[model samples]
Target: MGIKEFMISFIFTSILLSILFIPTLLTKSFAGIRPSSFSGHPQASPFPVSFAYLISASKGDLESLKRTLCALYHPANYYLLHLDLEASHEERLSLLKFVSAHPIFSQVGNVWIVEKSNLVTYRGPTMLANTLHAMAMLLKTCKWDWFINLSASDYPLVTQDDLIHAFSSLPRDLSFIQHSSHLGWKMNKRAKPIIIDPGLYNLKKSELMWVTKHRTVPTAFKLYTGSAWMVLSRSFAEFCVVGWDNLPRTLLLYYTNFISSPEGYFQTVICNSKDFKNTTVNHDLHYIAWDSPPKQHPISLGLKDYRRLILSFAPFARKFKKDDPVLDKIDREILRRNDGQFTYGGWCSERGESNATCTGFGRHENSGVLRPGAGSRRLKALIVKLLSMRNFKRKQCR
Candidate 1:
């Protein structure tokens, strides 16, 4: 939908929602929800904020995917898991079955798997297309304030309660995107090179093919590049998915031939738009550490980075080993999640008291329950610093 159409729709919905549930919308409470608030069912009383997560994984990543999903899962939130076409059919079926067999997932029915897998090349436009495809699906499916795209290798440092509580006081329009207009060396290598991903046309997976000819960077719209991970607002997600104006579509076409499109597509789109240029907080909300000199790809995080990780106070960290001991340490210390159980939250904390794991949620419905912890305090402090006057304005679209 276009911006005008979206505004009209949003106004109409808000009017009705405001009339029906004025108290809920006007709340600025970080004090977790209570059972006494709801009459009979808590489902009718939605959380203050929710996120839509797209977890993308490829071959040999089912276990990692499961662990990450469990850590990131929340009853109030929606999750869409995409397994690349490179994985076997049996593997995809296994993932679907795992989700279906899970007690919390089956009961809450908030998790979904992308049955129609797409061939995604590492740095090709297919990766960008896959992300957009998932975004379009989520935009049509559920209601969420923010859209976060993460890979299976990425893990959350804080509980979902911490994230939701920390963001409760902020404006919904703010998007956490690390971006800058300066391309530096990328101007010649990434922006000028032409590439064709065989994943687009071929049924099977293949490498990204390079073209001998190079084209000049377009003067119509300036290029921006940064971290591929982003915390996108629903408004921005809709604009990119629907192409309300020509900027999104024009950038899509331009970046089709560009290398590492994911790092630039959303950056270029958000910065070039007049409506969204100033609505950005210059951070990717991730604690990603690189090698001293930095290689072609980031180095995998291990136990050695634990102290620095906590100091960063970012909600998520990435490029971890599948079964890294650091993950276990983070689970025990930060997330409070057990080996195979979902993350510790008020939603299921009271349910599985016998084993003390968040296993079953159908017996006791506490989807509205949100108990923030010390991690919440850390996250809030970090966000406050990022949105401080000195950091917010100076780093935006620079």
Candidate 2:
């Protein structure tokens, strides 16, 4: 095609996507009930809260990313996937194609991709920036009770229906963020160091730069650190994205030079903001097992962890190897998902022999269709423990 024709076609596609994709992200929350009224035990209510997910992936992770998205899919939730700039164009294109062409995704219209990939550096501000970008996009486009951030290495231990059911009774204002005021060793190492992530500016990827001069810890606000993964309320997500109070933006600039900014940025912001500090529940809601004497990263989960994985009853687990046998085990036992099939939910009629696997073929039409499994009971137990008076009130901003 000629340049003029291609330009016109691109403009038409952009307009079409703006109409089709943006509004589709506005998922129905709590099956049409207000979030404030969603509190307390509502098991028979049949109304489940909605979640907005930002799932990130890096180079050579197309398969893992696809699997994670497939396992986490539910018609009630809105998903935004990102393949970082480091991935080859062909890989990104392949992922876009997968999302666009998936029968269920096309029908549900709940999945999206960050077509303009950002360059992210490990332990740098760019990683946090990438997450913030996703939050802004989701906040503007969707109305969800909670926001969840995960990576391709992470997979769900519970199906989406189980997650929705478990979280349905919980207060929508709560943010399940794992945080601690006691920085311990991080105070000197992470707080004092001045590191520069080239990914923030340069188009090409490079190693992080460490400045020679060290700085003193600020007295303006105390530094808190914790796990990068979190489940945030829409209110908290909006507070961070909007920065109306200026605290989130101030910390954004302060964390630009800090090591592993993602681990500390939201923690610092939420703890310092008194309005939301009381809403904190010090659990990331993920099952992550670190190595003995512990390294920087957690140990990859395997078949051996299956027993503990079930016992933990957390909604998600992390750092699994690509195409691991244990993932298949989780798919079969916990998620009830078959190879190449979407996770089962009540919204869809099952297909194949004995109707074992769910084929997510249609939309919910605003009211959710949830089929809670054993995983729902397991997760509800964990949620009870986390929200218990002894566990819930004592850990805030600490």
Query: How well does each candidate superpose onto the true structure, as a TM-score?
Result: 0.87, 0.86
Q: Name every residue pair that clashes in candidate 2.
A: 181-398
Model 1 C-alpha lDDT per residue in residues 95-206, reported as the tens digit of each score: 8778777765666667788767778888887788778777776776667889999999999999998998999899999999999899988899899977766676677877
* lDDT of model 1 at position 152: 94
Q: How much does each candidate deviate from the true structure in C-alpha RMSD?
A: 9.8, 9.5
Tens digits of per-residue lDDT, candidate 2, 184-222, equal 889888999777676766788898877666789999998
Count: clashes, candidate 2: 1
TM-score of 2: 0.86
Q: Which ten residues in a row have the lowest lDDT in candidate 2?
A: 29-38
**Shift in Å, residue 60, candidate 2:** 0.6
